[model samples]
Target chain A: MQKVGILGGGQLGRMLIQAGIDFDLDISVLDPDPNAPCKLFANRFEVGKLTDFDTVYQFGQTVDVLTIEIESVNVDALEKLHQEGKKVFPQPQVIRTIQDKRLQKQFYQTHQIPSPEFVLIDNKGQLADHADFLPAFQKLGKDGYDGRGVQKLTSPNDFEHGFDKPSLLEKLVDIDKEISVIVARNESGGMRTFPVVELVFHPAHNLVDYLLAPAQITPEQAAQAEALAQEVMLKLDMVGLLAIELFLTKEGKILVNEVAPRPHNSGHHTIKANGTSQYEQLWRAILNLPLGDTSAQSLAAMVNVLGASGHTGNAHYEGVNDTLGVKGAYLHLYGKKLTKPSRKMGHVTILDQTLQGLEEKIDLIKRSIKVVSK
Target chain B: MQKVGILGGGQLGRMLIQAGIDFDLDISVLDPDPNAPCKLFANRFEVGKLTDFDTVYQFGQTVDVLTIEIESVNVDALEKLHQEGKKVFPQPQVIRTIQDKRLQKQFYQTHQIPSPEFVLIDNKGQLADHADFLPAFQKLGKDGYDGRGVQKLTSPNDFEHGFDKPSLLEKLVDIDKEISVIVARNESGGMRTFPVVELVFHPAHNLVDYLLAPAQITPEQAAQAEALAQEVMLKLDMVGLLAIELFLTKEGKILVNEVAPRPHNSGHHTIKANGTSQYEQLWRAILNLPLGDTSAQSLAAMVNVLGASGHTGNAHYEGVNDTLGVKGAYLHLYGKKLTKPSRKMGHVTILDQTLQGLEEKIDLIKRSIKVVSK
Candidate 1:
């Protein structure tokens, strides 16, 4: 049996385990938490830190091919494994460029990829020198996700209190909508990309509230974004799935925001809306199998079920039953033992034959569902 | 957490384990073999005979709800468990009637359902008394599947040499084509049926070789079959997926042939073709959740991949790569350790926007692929 080892055991890893069944491939997952969601479905489960070289090296020994669910894995260990003749998808180089925001922006600049202008700051002292670049968007070099480690600076005083150590200050372009394109590639250079999806975030929390596929953009803009995503994949020389976050400016220009090197949150809607899910596509691409269809059968919107504020005891889903009663509403509760405010507990994807219909159903789901703690 | 215990640890159980991830429910499976296909994915796996009352009853004690992959499970133990407050879907009484051909036929007659004429015979002596019923079809009432334990008797002398006790004799059906309807129902009598699918079996093997959805039948005939299936569900009070096999006679009459009380193989195409898969629907129905949409997104055909005769060593597929190259062909391989002649190892479902195109693709898939053992 061909065994595929995954580096992290988050929800993406959990979903990948389900996709592995389609090909009957054996799966082994490594994560620090024993109760990680992917552990139960994988063929073998190992509790180990993702960034520890020894742990990753040991996990690599048991599988025919290796992949990652989270980008914050030990890249040096993955490079070693790749050199030792083990197939590592989303190659080590791709992870190296994406793990750090500073290097990621530099890579885009080096590749002539169109992205927002940014200035790299080595420390707080360097920020003083780039003070003229105020009103900048400050992002930590590494370990950032879901709007964390990112801030908008409107004055020079904001730079003085910016993040410690290495960071990047990018020009915050006036955006109309935040979008993402999930693309898959094989070792043989075969590639395919799903339609761009516009992300709508919660007004107060700034966390993604819903994902709208076939982003409300003109055909020309969609085509340009798809082509740009393909170019990014070729430049990265990446395999497996790559999710490219993009910004649509008011001037009708598309700029690269960032990229994730695994099965992404934005593509979750594909599980119910498309012919082949993003999880399934990741497995097929990594295994070098022919990719399945990527066409969506309907308009789909996904709503993340974030934990409500001031409730952090045992999880209790209020109004979940009522939300389930809505036609085409699919609720997926991540089996987490605890709930914290701003933490994603689960999500629901609603699909309909028309965009207006999907939007109406999503509005109902948004109003009727609550993820809280008892 | 509501725990569910499954009786058979095969592919059906494995698929259920995958679906259980979405609901965050715990699943345990019991099977006679230690290396059952479902062992790798289920939350807990126990080795025990499915037909052993003690084993089944003991397994049922660990879960709140109980179900089965195959109907051959011990009904007496399930009945005892149900009496003790365990929720057994497709109730034990339903399984008892469906497990044996004679009992199943009797139940149909008792309910005034339309079926072919048949007679139950305890031994060859009983058959001799009905000698005038020559050229009859004889089938062993128990342990019959995939054309096994069934034969056509040309004369009274034919039953003298090769005779089995407790068999049923019926008029040989002159079939134009075989078809099946899959229906799902909850305990509250809420039910829905998928579009009818026509089955094309291998001539000599008599195993379902291909399944074409939205069977090429008149609208009246499809309506008749669907209505009959719902009536059976209401009569049986089945609370899960029910697959009713039917024979379309040369005269265009539909006759009920048999029933499977779980996610049937005939509905596998729904995984890719329909809005909701039979696996997901079964989970929802048994859990008392509202049934999902069973409408097809496109036309589809499912072809079973059986191991070739005289080639049974280690299982290795020869034409898998070629088959994968076909557009819209979705392959599902059951993780089985061994392969023998006529062993069902996997299946491929082809989907298309049009029925005519799907039919053409089915012919291409049949001609291009061969399921051979290493």
Candidate 2:
């Protein structure tokens, strides 16, 4: 087995390594935090900044292939490594484009991919010129992640919320629902896709609250979503997993919301719902192996387990026993020591033959379990 | 979460740790082999003799609860730990009884479990005294594993093949299919049985060649098997996973063949086929959490990947890429550094909605993969 190294050893890396173990692949991980989730199981763990070029270069040198769990990793070193013949999946160029919101939106537009209308702004003052683009969102072009560096500007009065740095202001879509399609492309140009899933986000948190697999969409809509995801992946000319978040407008139009170049939160339910998890598909893609079946075996719903409000310090789980008592509920806790408010702690996957049963369990899980500090 | 310790660090321990990662449990393993499979993923790995009293006792002191992956571990140390209020399950007494063939057989008879008739004997000389039981099997009372320490005696002329040490002569039932029902009992006395599975053994090797979930038997027979397994587990008062291997005689009678006090080979397909894997079920049992659902999500067949007959030394997999291309095929490779003929290197699980499709994939997997030397 070839040695595989991952940058940013958080829960995604932890899960990818877990899936890799089945193949007996030798895996190493580099993360700035010594307590990163992958530290315990990775074959080798290097504590270094993922964004530091020298740190990434040294780590990438030790492996035959390199991939990332998060897109914030230093891509220049990755490009150099790829130029020198080391395999880097979702190639550095793709990562570089996805890392900047401006480039990501531009890439979609340039490829004729349907997305929301947007205008580039250099500073908060520039927002004054785009008042007609009101009822929009001002998103920083760089370093914005997981609801951060993003603000809704519904009117001229919201101009103060805009970033002073370069940003993109986009008109908001009246979303009927949000959906994600995970697609895997191998080096041989073989591609496979998991069933499209609906993502219902927390109204306040902006994080996925729960998701249903085999999203309740018409066959034509499902086909449209899959085709759009494939198109995005093909345009990037990428080899790896791509998570395409899309919004179905109330007017019956599908628009690309944003794109994640690596394993995204939307695909986590595949660990138990699909024949092959997104993590495993990433491995197959990066290794140039055949992509696995992406069909869902049963209806599944996943609820993210975030740290409870006003909780900090060593993490403790409450009602785990009771929650597990629910039939078909599978709990996964990322082995993190702390539990700060709203931090991604873990998730629970609920599998049921019927969507109603799945929804019932999801509600039960949400009400039963809490990640708190002891 | 309490710290857990496992006595053996083979593939079973490796798998247990893999499942435990989901719960973020702190797990440690004690095994004599420095390169034990669990060494890579266990939170702590101690290279020490599992059968040594001191080593077992010292290892038990480091964890809140202890369990075993192999039956050969030092039971006296486990008994001592249990006496000292440390949790050891299936409980040391259950392990002790299951460890010796003589006691295990006697236990079944005393409890009126539907097992084959057997007679305890002191030596080969005693076997000749019972000519009526000539076609029985002579099984060593202790330290017998896999297919070792057992010989088939068809007539008085075969008495010379019997063991000289204390052993048992068990009457062989008329030929029929073999099946396994895995029952789990938690500390709270909650019990659950995985759907009965049929095991087909290799005629030459006497080990499970492949197995199918939801064994092709009448519902009445399946119920009987589940009832029988539950009866055995309740009688033993064991707290953990118990794999009950039984023979469905030609007369339509189910007879107990043997039992293992930990996760058994018959349940490996559950990792992807069942609602909850046996590994996770075992964790729930020992941890006193509620037993999980054991229903099959999809029909599944598992084929063992043994080391090729003429290959040895540094292990390598042949045709992994091609085999992975098979739809619904899931490969699990134990991280063994070396391979020799007939060594259990890994397994491939083929799942499908129909039994015919599953069997076809199983055959394809068997022909496509081989464990050989580099």
Against the true two-chain complex, what DockQ does each candidate achieve?
A: 0.65, 0.74
Model 2 / residue B319 / CA error / Å: 1.4
What digit string (tens of lDDT, one per residue) describes model 2 on residues B1-374?
A: 57999999999998898888888888899999998888877878999998999999999999999999999989999989999999999899999999999999999999999899999999878987888986888999999998899888998988876789999999989958899999999989999999999987778998667898889999999999999999999999999999999999999999999999999999999999998999999999999999999988888898888999999999999989878999989889999999999999998888888987887787788889999998
Candidate 1's residue-wise lDDT over B85-140, tens digit each? 99999799999999998999999999999898898999877887777776788888
Tens-digit lDDT string for candidate 2 (A265-369): 888889988999999999989888899999988899888899999999999999899889999898999999899999999999888989778878888889999
RMSD of each: 1.8, 1.7
Model 1 spans with C-alpha error above 4 angstroms: A201-207, B201-208
Candidate 1: clashing residue pairs, number: 0
Cα shift from native, residue B44, model 2 (Å): 1.3
lDDT for A177 in candidate 1 is 82
lDDT against the true structure, per candidate, is 0.86, 0.91
- What is candidate 2's local distance difference test score? 0.91
Most lDDT-accurate candidate: 2
Q: Across residues A71-122, which tens digit of lDDT does each residue of candidate 1 receive?
A: 9999999999999999999899889999999999999999999899999878
